[model samples]
Target chain A: MKAKIHVYLKPGVLDPQGAAVAGALHNMGYDEVASVRQGKLIELDLTGDDVEAARVRVDEMCAKLLSNPVIESYSIELE
Target chain B: MKAKIHVYLKPGVLDPQGAAVAGALHNMGYDEVASVRQGKLIELDLTGDDVEAARVRVDEMCAKLLSNPVIESYSIELE
Candidate 1:
């Protein structure tokens, strides 16, 4: 089984890295770019076959280690 | 318009960050975890409404700035 996780900052949180990207894009003549938000994508290979079980476990992992719950949220996709 | 970009290291590249993550999961009792790869997810807001032009521009951005062509591959989704 494979699990893909996207961990992103919450809406109210400020993202300096994202701001830098946006600024750089604007400098490069991509004036259409209004905003940018950066996040993490983690792809994991697991031994399990049950999608439900994998989803539950991966969600727990996100809460415990993969993401900072105070400022970030994560979504999990299992296949 | 909104664009979502996923940038990841090409397969066969040594990802120390991912290896550390996998090791951490193992230490946390996630024995089912076989391997892990870490990447970037970037979301951008644009002023334009043309999906085709946005896609082309975003693809160029990935090639020129968002990702390293030598070691990374990127995919773009426009909405």
Candidate 2:
């Protein structure tokens, strides 16, 4: 099984990298671009065939090490 | 309108970050985790309401700046 975790900065948090990207887009003539937010996607391949177990384990992974619970939020998709 | 771009390393490419994360997961007791791949997600808020135009512009952004075409692939979604 495989699990994918998407991590994003919580709403209301400042994202300097996103802001920089927006600025670059504007300078590149993409004035239509008003704002930007950047995030991360982590894909994990697991040995287990149990979908439920993989999801639970990945959820634990996210909470323990994959994300900063205070500033970021994560969602998981299992396949 | 908003556009999302998902940039990922092409298959067969080495991803040191992913490897490091996998190793960390293993050390943390997620031995079931066999492999990991990390990617990026970029969200753009735009002024125009034209979804099609936003998609096209973001596609160009990904191709020219957001992703390295040689070793990365990008997908864009607009809403």
Candidate 3:
């Protein structure tokens, strides 16, 4: 099984890296870019076969180590 | 318009960050985790409403700034 996780800052959180990217885009003349927010994508190769069990375990992984719950939220997709 | 881009290392490219993450997971006793790869997710808020033109411009952004074409590949989603 494979798990694809997207971890992103929660609403109301400030993202300095994202702000830098937006500023760069503006300097590069991509004026259409209004804002940018950066996040993380983590792909995991796992040994399990059961989708349900994998989903549960992966969710646990996100809460335990993959994300900072106070500031970031994560979503997981398993295949 | 909103654009979501995922940028990742190309296959066969060495990823030290990913290796470190896998090592951490193993140390934390996630034995089912076989391997892990880390990537970037960038969300952009744009001023334009035309999806087609936004796609083209975003692709250009990826080629020129968002990703390193030699060792990284990117996928874009518009909403």
Q: Which has the greatest DockQ?
A: 1
My TM-score estimates for the predictions, one after another, are 0.98, 0.96, 0.96
TM-score of model 3's chain A: 0.96
Task: List fnat, each candidate.
Answer: 0.93, 0.94, 0.93
Task: Return the lDDT, model 1, position B22.
Answer: 99
Worst 10 residues of 2 chain A by lDDT: A48-57
Instruction: Show where candidate 2 strays beyond 4 Å.
Output: none
What C-alpha lDDT, on a 0 to 100 scale, does residue B52 get in candidate 1?
A: 93
Lowest summed lDDT window (length 10), candidate 3 chain A: A48-57
Can you give the DockQ of every candidate in the order shown? Answer: 0.93, 0.91, 0.90
Ranking by DockQ: 1, 2, 3
| Interface Cα RMSD in Å, per prediction | 0.6, 0.7, 0.7
lDDT of 3 by residue, B1-79 (tens): 9999999999999999989889988988898999999999999999969999999999999999999999999999999
Q: Using alpha carbons, what is the TM-score of model 2?
A: 0.96
lDDT values for all models: 0.95, 0.92, 0.95
